[model samples]
Target chain A: MVDYFNEDITSLHDKLVRKEISVRQLVEATYDYIDKTEGKVNAFITLNKEAALKQADALDEKGVDPDNLLSGIPLGIKDNIVTKGLKTTAASHILDNFMPVYNATVMDKLDALDTITVGKTNMDEFAMGGSTETSYFGKTHNPWNLDKVPGGSSGGSAAAVAAGEVIAALGTDTGGSIRQPAAFNGIFGIKPTYGRVSRWGLMAFGSSLDQIGVMSRTIKDSALVLNAISGHDEHDGTSAAADVPDFTAALNQDIKGLKIAVPKEYMDEGVDDDVVSAIKAAIATFEKLGATVEEVTLPYTKYAVPAYYIIASSEASSNLQRYDGIRYGFRAKDVNSLKSVYVRSRSEGFGDEVKRRIMLGSFSLSAGYYDAYFKKAAQVRTLVKRDFDQLFEKYDLVLGPTAPTSAFGLGEKITDPVTMYLNDILTIPANLAGIPAASVPAGFSKDGLPIGVQLMAKALDEATIFKAADAFERHTDFHNQVPAFKGGQN
Target chain B: MISKEQVTHVADLARLEFDEAQLNNFTTQLDKIVDFVDQLNEVDTTGIEPTTHVTSAVNVFRDDVPQKGEGRAALLKNVPEERDGLIRVPAIIDKEED
Candidate 1:
């Protein structure tokens, strides 16, 4: 039986406040779980035992104060988030040993709340790939089925939560990096509307598309984390100045009369039957709860992926150019000239996936072709956003499958970049429109892999997302299931 | 069609070299991708405005006032070679005498 230790964040905090368990004990239990399960999952890239324990001990010394909502809770960070004096690798060979001199804005917010970060988690090289196979370090396996991949580039964060390694972790979403992986791994993950969370200190990959996200086993816990880490930051110029609602406070609110739009375009031919059934079942549950469900069409939804690719790659080409062996990262030692050093360092440091993206980005942004490809893609992006704008006029939230299919075999789609890119089709539309989207554990496929149902909301309306996601979780038992590790009986 | 020569040229422009096998592989892969992306030509976008950012906001810039600096040493510490506190590199473009 899973112990009370496995309780969600809010309940765990309540227990802490009641003095049922000390903060030190919770921190120790988290580390114990990490030590036990990390061998099988390989979720964390760096686990700073000293720093984590110190933070936990300090929180304990401060005692249970009413002001500390997330005090003493041990958390994991995606490697892309910069933490002072820790290696912020983004799971790339180029930055294997590069240390950050400062913390990301989100980290500072979490720090202010006294949340103890255990360490940085793994990711695809520069958060580039979907399967996590493209990580410079070895791939992170699915907690459910070891042979299958954990979805990525937030694979490590999702896997860690699913494997009970960390209660929660932070992830960054550019093109469904958080939600898709959360869906694949059978956990709750959320990508807030662009600018809802600050982007300072996150290694840039499609700067306009990137938003820091959260992953956890329960929707409420995910929302709690979101509330803690999200807010305006002057450090990040793109951050929104909108006031953050108390996500946990409004989670229990009824969705009795809320109108939901399920885009017909997302239910096209390529979508798997099992995924469709799961979403339909979720819709039925919503209808029973008194929420009105209707079909809405995002006619330009089909154009989202291509448009996302052009814009994201074009931006990435420019963002990644800063890592040309002239700054703090891996540099080729034997090269004689600066040109040779730049070329050789990048050539040797970046993995195949990273190189492919850099090449694609450069190609997309190249002279003469930008108008035909990048500019045209931008126009299509506007159309995609317009479709969402129209849909929001009639609906409270949008719901769909996070991916067309379930978690695939590790190497099945890696060789074909386009096929791999297709895994994020449904989730990318939200990013393209700069809206908030989340993937919650809906149910399992016949093969027992997890299936995810996504809830997306209009810009800066995360309260709606939390309410709907919490409502879904309250009616489902999928999040209760845990993965059996190696040598463990299921 | 993308040739090995074009691949070499692009690679040179990007400041990298690929092995023979990698060149062959990338050429084939890039050719297919370029062709697939060409499908975008079907949609006619005569007067539509290009969207540079998804959100309606514009010119998201932080204040120009300096808050903190990690120092020049940390910034230039990883340069492969430096002379007189400046990064040293081979001349890709020739310098003219005054």
Candidate 2:
């Protein structure tokens, strides 16, 4: 078995800085781990072995600045975030061989730091599903249990971090894509406020809701990675110009007297009892720390899911309109006319879940139903945002379960689209509210699968997310436990 | 309230070809989904301003700088046929299959 102590990035970085380990050694060990687990986990879609080694050799030969936060780190990136000269499929058949000519803003930022991006990870095609099962490449199974799914469309990133394939990874959350999978996989993941990270090259899902997120084994690692990637970029018009605090610097903030609100609505009705208990236990830990806790109601919380589907799908339909098989991606043969090309390419390119979304989105945005569905959902979205605003006035942050349940059996709900959609029932409200939320593993379920407790902060308040998650991680050993697959010989 | 034919029509518009069984399945599934969506009608939205974006960002117009990537001109160029910078399709407006 690989030594988890040495394998962890935090420890690896410490060792590398202390001259106990070399970048070459760290890179080789990472490759060895990936070689052992890739066949079973299939977390990565693209691993540039030669390029990785070449970079590692350069880092070893020239040496890196010891003070650099991620000087000699290896990381995974979700394929949707473009990397110049690398094939970025977003796990869709359409872009199977498409190579990006430009790096995404986040990639450029990280590249400036010289962080080694080891591979491109898997995800649901066009990021349209809750499980990586929708991936055209194939389903990515949970590392904890091969029979179960890794939550998605950021599943690959979450699983990669959980399985220790990479120190950390970047994920995009349009509607709980990052946090839900992180919750399911039992790792730390944060979807920064909508404009916290630039979306310059990410294939748009819900443009308004989508934000680049970070995933890692611990909250400190997540914050370190977030600090590197969070900032304003002129390329993304939606990028915030507001000042961003040093997330890593604020990691040790005290939780005492921090007003935490437990949304009673999230605990009642649809939440799984075991998951709720775990969250309640987590909240109790906070209370024991001298933090004030109170019950708050986001009355319109029930409407969050429907409002989310309508708005996310509507944005998806418009965003996905770009994939017509002409510019790039898979183009169908024997298409006599352009119309046939558009229809056939998309119909064949997208998976069933994606098609379902496109159709629903089209209907919602269609002329007749616009006011009835799309418009109404938007109005409710405001009410949902209002709930967060009202609650934030009284509380420093809001806490809830990331999902109603935990990592389900691989094919359990895949056949039933509604059941599959309901997986993000809890996470969707944060997306609708446009808040920054992070999922930290609370505890294990009865079946031994991981359940996540989420903390959401007001827009651009990543400091609060880090503060709460940091304090929580300091209290729990859950972040230190690696999945069974991490046993090197697996 | 959507019929099987309506589903088929929308499928055709989306250019997806489903078999009879899949069609029937999609019809039933979509009917339930549409019914679920119909619940939006229950909330009295009288005088509630419809919000398409939560941030209230409007027109979000980036400067219309000339660029070579998939643009309006490039998209119009891909349509089966175009007349004076517009997509040309069979006139479905007048041929309503009532």
Candidate 3:
């Protein structure tokens, strides 16, 4: 029997092609793996077992084909992306029973190439909080340590991949949702430029910042996924029309003469000492690899956290208005008036974080406050982007820590919203600047929690990130360290 | 700092219901957050144009044609209350449905 759960996508694809394993057997083995590890991980909100088995059986009958890019590989999808006939909750009670009638364009892109999606994984409620602890379904634990949070709102997606629950997963990033979780879980996740991937099927958190990207075990594996899903779709007005590249081709590229920058602003006092040392070590590694590393200043780095919250919350307040109890999902009881129905259903259906964001957004967008808060924040966003534009003119990429520290305890910062929001400080600049960024497992903290080193390149320059991250992985074995699962009948 | 009455007005605008305890809880928490984010006021943003989106994509229009996607039956299937394939809601004028 194949150790299906432990294998990466490339080798898994090779084995299927050589008749070393049948697709049905592979799918069954994955199910066994999930049963053994899921209790400890709590990654999925809904497992697609019945349908996956049926599909795998049909795929086995057709015989394995390697020409198909994904070719029967197993994947996990974040809950916010819709799949026809399957429940997509965004890890909130309001959408607890919401079933989609159509698959996301990304799902359709993967489906055409025959990738088997195993389940919809859990995440922070409506993709708001930095920790998965805010999810209505309950928290997703960091696979490395049960007490710590898996960074969110793509926490489950990163956690599942780290624990070998799925080969890879799709996650949406708005202000570092995908990268932070991937860092916290010691995996590789890429948040392509804002318009690089279609957002048509994604649940909107911050419309201008949100983009669907890959969360995977390795940069190469994620590159293959990016190859299948990146392009313009008429459905999403903002999707970029740039030609999709063969991202996998970038894996072996030489970074010998690549000019890179290390942001001085992010290395400020807010960064944890252990994380700073790890990222410094990473920069030294890049320098040793023949890449030139120098200091660059993004003078407005401190402003990203506040600006992102205001901009994202303002958009979220507008986006979440569709969840009134009249159609789809959960509704309130004992409401006599239409106005009461709107208020009661929403207040009861949403979690604390969701409510806070909506209120925050409402306050920002209110008549008297718009010009001072929302408009000022948007102008700050322009300055942030201009920072990137000026630096990218001289350097090929910029590097920093994905977060200030490694994954913290589950309830550590949730009590104070500002403290929780501070976790996104280093990662939000890329979102504000509309650039592509990625997090690769750099090292571990003193407590053994994983730390991630971030790499940001200009828009549509995903190849540079892959090239650099692939180089780092080749020289280190940190990504190979799997969390020892503990709990529930295994 | 935002007062309790102002907090209530924002919640009303957001269409979210809250009891007295919740209002108090939120007021305390939100005041700290707002005060924290008010640091943005210190930056010089004069003559800087607001960036609505970071991309150059604009004015994209798709062909108006029939497409096969999710149908009405599946959509209406999730309604909390329904009648004759229409989603039912409480009366807008404060009248309860029996």
lDDT of each: 0.84, 0.82, 0.90
lDDT of candidate model 3 versus the reference: 0.90
Kindly report which residue stretches of model 3 are placed more than 4 angstroms away from their true locations once superposed.
A4-6, A486-490, B66-69, B95-98
lDDT of 3 by residue, B1-92 (tens): 99999999999899997899999999999999899889999999999999989888667777788888567887788889999988888766
Residue-by-residue lDDT tens digits, candidate 2, A6-51: 3555676778777787777877888898888788788888887778
DockQ of each: 0.43, 0.23, 0.73
Output the lDDT of residue A391, model 2. Answer: 88
Judge candidate 2 at residue A293 and give its lDDT.
86
Deviation (Å) of A190 in candidate 3: 0.3
How many pairs of residues collide in model 3? Answer: 0
Which portions of model 1 miss their true places by more than 4 Å? A1-5, A486-490, B61-64, B72-98
> A1-490, model 3: which lDDT tens digit per residue?
6563457788888888887888888888888988977778799999999999989988988877768748888899999999988899999999899988788899999888889989999899998989988888888888888778899999999999998878899998999999999999999999998888888788888999998999998888999999999999878888999998899888877789999989898788989999999998998899899999999899999998899999999999999999998888789999888888888899999999999999999999999999999999999999999999999999999999999999888789999999999999999999999899999999999878899999999999999899999999998888888775432231
Better of 2 and 3 by DockQ: 3
Ranking of all candidate structures by their DockQ, best first: 3, 1, 2
Error of 1 at A436 (Å): 0.6
Q: Judging by TM-score against the true structure, name the best candidate.
A: 3
Sort by lDDT, best first: what order? 3, 1, 2
Model 1 chain A: weakest 10-residue lDDT segment is A481-490
